[model samples]
Target: MKEFIDYLLKFGDLNEQQISCITANAVETELRKDAYFAEAGKVVRQTGFMTEGILRNYYYNSKGEEITKYFVEENNVVICKASFDNEIPATSYLQAVTDCRLIIFPKKNWEEISGTVMIWDSLMQKIISRALVRKVERISPLVSQDATTRYLEFLEHYPGLANRVPLSYIASYLGITQQSLSRIRKNIR
Candidate 1:
């Protein structure tokens, strides 16, 4: 809990009481592998911090294939920001890739905290900025690179995600077929 508070403090200084309230009041949950943190069409009422394990955000296409959008590892914040920010039904699914421990807060609680705490407002702003940066970085390959080049860039960005996540999922995240990814791997070697 102190660790969580310390991370929050980086955005802005918070009163000790505010920090205590945020930590003590937030819900702590544990989820098993394949469990969903949130799903499409559900109203996402909570925002969370991933304290352990891995999670992924994905959406399904008309054909029912999952398209991976973002993966969050331990110590990162995990929220469907589009739903959370707009108070609408979620368009993406949030799933646990491994057994996970999470600290979560209701959207109402988040709103109340931001109203009274400058630190909370600053934290929200920082999160929004980071999300935008991540989206821009994800689009870089489409403009300047071919499939093989994009595969290399993916490795450069994530280093060892191939070992950590399923190859098919990584391929989907890269917007390429698994066969194409296999060909790229052979070409690299």
Candidate 2:
């Protein structure tokens, strides 16, 4: 809860009443490693503020292979806005790569809060805009970079995650085979 408040405060000021309103609808959940916060074909009904651990968003490609799309770590918010906005099922899944603690706001209440609280909508916009920009930045690398370069870029961007995340997931994230990631690791060493 503190983490959520602190993160939002970075984007905009929140008074006690506004904080109370938002917190009133927020719920805390814990997931063991490998648990999923959301799954494909289900509607994503909440926006989560990750307080602890990491999550990966993914989709199965046309070949039925899981392709990792993005990572959400502590202090990050995870939502499938396309689904959330349209009130439809999600096309991807959000799974915990590590045990996680999350403070989440229900989508229905979030809508109301934006109207009730000053700057809530602005804070949300700032948060979502930042997330969109980050999404674009992460996606842009995959098409332009080779596997080894992608791995290096991943390390450059998320240095601490390399050891914590499984090599298989990292390989998927880099759009490379596990054997390829192993070779890259060997070359780096």
Candidate 3:
């Protein structure tokens, strides 16, 4: 919860009372490897602050290939905005890449918290906006850069994640085959 509170601090200060109010609604949740936080065809019912492990946001193509769009590491928030906002089925899946700990707030408590903690909505807006900007920045490079350049950028950007995540998932994230990623790694070494 400290990680979540610290993340919220980026928006503004929170008094002890406000913190208590917010914390009162938080619930700890866990996901084992490959567990889905938000599955495709299910509506998002909670917003989670990831305290440990990693999550991959992915979708399946018509050919049934998994296309990894992004990775959410520890100390980040996880939410399926489209499904949460529209109250419709999710198009993407948020799956745990490793055992995970998350501080979650159910949608049922949203009205109570958002109404009481005036800054909560604003804080979320900023976080989501920043994420979208980063998404755009990442997408541009994927389209313009070569696979090697993209893989190098990934290594630079994500640091230890290359070692932590499975090679196949990393390859999917790079929009390349596992064989190509292996060859790149060999050549680079």
Q: Best-fitting candidate, measured by TM-score?
A: 3
Tens digit per residue, CA lDDT, model 2, 42-112: 88888878999999999999999999988999989888888888889899999999999998878888787
- Tens digit of per-residue lDDT, candidate 1, span 30-133: 98999999899988888888888888889999999989886777767878887888879999888888788988888877877777666676777796687679
Looking at model 2, residue 72 earns an lDDT score of 90
User: What would the per-residue lDDT of candidate 3 be over residues 1-189, giving only the tens digit for each residue?
Assistant: 889999989878889988998899999889999999999999898888899999999999999999999999988889898888779999999999999999998997766789899888888899899889977877778888988999998987788999889999999989999999999999898
- Candidate ranking under TM-score, highest first, comes to 3, 2, 1
- Candidates in order have lDDT scores of 0.81, 0.89, 0.90
Candidate 1, number of clashes: 0
Question: In candidate 3, which residue pairs get closer than 3 Å at backbone N, Cα or C atoms, i.e. clash?
Answer: none
Candidate 1 vs candidate 2: the TM-score winner is: 2
In model 2, how large is the Cα lDDT of residue 10? 92
TM-score result, candidate 2: 0.95
Q: CA lDDT of 149 in candidate 3? A: 94
Error at 112, model 1, angstroms: 3.8
Clashes of each: 0, 0, 0
TM-score of each: 0.87, 0.95, 0.97
